[model samples]
Target: MMNKGIDREIDWRLRVFESLSYPTIILLPDRTIIAVNGRYLEKMGVEEEEIIGRSCREVNLRNYPEQKFPCAEQGECPLARAVHTRSGQSVLLKYHDVYGGEGWEERVFSPILGADGEVDFIIESIRDVTRVKNLEKMYSGVRELIDQVVQTSVSGIIAADRQGRIILMNRAAEELFGYSGYDIDNVNIEDYYPPGVAREIMRKLRSEEIGEKGKLPITRVTIRRKDGAEVPAEMTAVIIYEDGREAATAGIFNDLRDKLEVERQLKEAHAQLIQSEKLASLGRLAAGVAHEINNPLTGILLYASMMREKLEKDHPLEQNLRYIIEDTQRCQEIVKNLLAYSRQSNPTRQYFQLNEALGESLRLVRDQKLFLHVKVVEDAPAAPVLVNADKNQLCQVVINLIINAVDAMDGNGTLTLRTYEDRPNRKAILEVSDTGGGIPAENMSKIFDPFFSTKEVGKGTGLGLSMAYGIMEENHGRIYVKDTSPEGTTFALELPLVPMSDVILFDSIG
Candidate 1:
């Protein structure tokens, strides 16, 4: 009965060995295959009679020559290694099975110790791991593709960790920020935004008012550049999550300098079209007025000259006669201005204090009827802001801007004139701001156009800004809308600066 139980147990062990999915072989210490499972016999397409008692190394070399590692070329395999180390060993190999299928295989060799702790036998098992290996390769390729796409994108992409530390920045971001890889190492992400901007962005990102929570949609914002300039940009940002918790944040930015410039040009072009139409209609009126006034003005000039010549020197009537001639000439000048709505007059260039010209412009209209209810505030530094430009034309531009500001306010508002010295760019900026309703969006495009005006027929000629634009261009200067809102509008005029070293020292010589 004991012998019968022993035979039953052996049969059960053989059945379990055959049930393994992986190919299995039992080998002796000398690399000889002593026993083989049914799985191995089936995979090798050979009967157990052929592989049993055969050498494991010889069978692998003859049927599975593609098996690699364990220095098989040197007559050593994982089976031999397992016996020598008294432990398990593994090797990866590519193989062709009996059914003509090809894939990756993990060959493992586990030593079976005897009662004396000596490796008496080894078990060789081959596990097909092609699916796992293929998955890893696919994952690697995907990661590489994502990295390439980010680096080559036109929009600037930046990512940061939960600690607000900058962790990644793409090539476009580097170019936009004017920073290098080594330059921004260990830099905090908050350093890129202006004061309180990062906090506000985070707050909005978490709030549902502006956009979906954890996502800030595309919107305009200001970023602080490496050179200390506040640049306009459009940005979209999102919070990264891991396991339902915030992990990091990423932002995509688009520079708006070029876009804003294109819009401004389009507006200017439209404004010019409207201005031209009005100038054409009103130019005919100016011509008619000049023609009708010239004959009468010439007659008065001739009679006044004769009367002044006949009168004695230092006589009271002589002075009155000279006044008539002078006043007539001033009237003639006024007529010339009427016809000069579209004229481009030459300017005399010289070095002058920009602040002085601004002051002069303010003084010329300080006591005027329109200025009675207007408050003028000058915000220029005490130091002279010198510029090389046409002094008269510069003052004319300032005066025109002031008049526009006053009119925009309907004769009752604060007019602030501010000046700034931009020595780095060698520019002098003068801004005229007024507390009034902002210019209409539709009218903004027509402001610089000929004949464009918001005023009534007789109140304006629609040529003030057109003439101002032409004068600015002639003087190598620029004029632009500095800032505007429902509460106010500011127009800025920029001119080239005259360095102190080049300033004439007439005062010192005298």
Candidate 2:
């Protein structure tokens, strides 16, 4: 009963198969077209009645003079081998169509076996995979091009996972970090950066605190080299993702040793120029001192003018008296300003309050109407921020910065003055910020250079800030511009704080 049921199922399968539209062709064990559906007969350009009893040679393979059917006789074909060995197999074969002479076809032959383990029939299915094959070829070519590019790049490229293990290191990376590509793969990235710097960076990365796109987090750091020397470098990192998951981070580093040396040399050159200007101004003031001596002698001339007006009625010395008075007053004013500009004049060094110094400087410029249209804001802590600096020199620095701020604003804008303590190193800081046309990029490097002024001719000698910088340096302090943008510029001065013991001694000496 089971045998009968199996036979019945097989007969039903053959009946259902003939109803399909695909070109289904069944080949007999003798390599003859024993059965075919309507689609097969249409594809092969043969009548169903004529092809059922015909051998495979009549429909095709007639050109093979050596084998009756090249597929079966050669026994090398996948379908042929499967039939001979009574094992199932699949193989791709190319053939020309008789009706469509210009087209070629790829056919898949699947061999089937009987219960006796002999070849029963073969089912062939065909498809055109030409477009898919072309796409595969294009992808392979692109991969080859990318491989060539990476091999020849000059910049070092390194990628690491969230765990800090390196996944990729190019040839340049091998030379830069002093490790071969093979040695770095799977190694921790911490071995490159200075101790603790790597951990800090990783913490920021985990917290998403790094700079956003269109910006860079340029942190100067020291990286360990293969020879054990730490190299100064500016590092930049970028995050990468794959399939919506964080995959790794890529880092690129540039050497800063040469750039730093160049900046140092420029600073030295600028310092020398300032020192020369200071000496030159001293010489000019010395010549003016000789002329100033005539001021006291001119007082005698004024008394003679009065006597002449009282006793010498015939002389009429009124015009001479007027000339003497005018020249003497001019000499006195010159002598006063000359003393102020001369650095040789010893300014009293004291623990002066920053707010007092700012008040003094503002008072000097306040009488002028230049600041009328401008808003001057002062933001400082209430605590006394005292420093050991020459009182006049400190006032001068503040005055120069304030005047420059006014000039930059070009008549109407905001100016800010602030003071605070640099607690870490025991320093007091004063900052002057202004809203105005900012300095140009090219002139920024030369802003502190003596006589390098951008102001209109006769409006500036550019010696004010240069002098300010020199005075700050002499007091064991430093001054610099923090930033400049379209909005404005900010100048900052940091001076070391004087302890209470020194302040008392200074006041006693005074």
Best by lDDT: 1
State the lDDT of candidate 1 residue by residue for 18-135, as single tens digits.
Answer: 8888999888889888888888888888887788777876787777676664567675667767878899998888766668776788988889899999998888898889899889
- Each prediction's total of clashing residue pairs, residues at least 3 apart in sequence or on different chains, is 10, 0
Cα deviation in Å at residue 488, candidate 2?
1.9
Model 1 spans > 4 angstroms off: 1-12, 65-70, 73-76, 96-102, 165-168, 177-185, 224-230, 264-284, 307-323, 340-510
Query: Cα lDDT of model 2 overall?
Result: 0.72
TM-score per prediction, in order, is 0.65, 0.44
The TM-score leader among the candidates is 1
> What C-alpha lDDT does candidate 1 achieve relative to the native structure?
0.84
Measured with C-alpha atoms, the lDDT of residue 330 in candidate 2 is 66
Model 2 collision count: 0
Tens digit of per-residue lDDT, candidate 2, span 54-152: 766565554323323335565466556667766555543333344533232355566786797666887765455555656766898998897667656
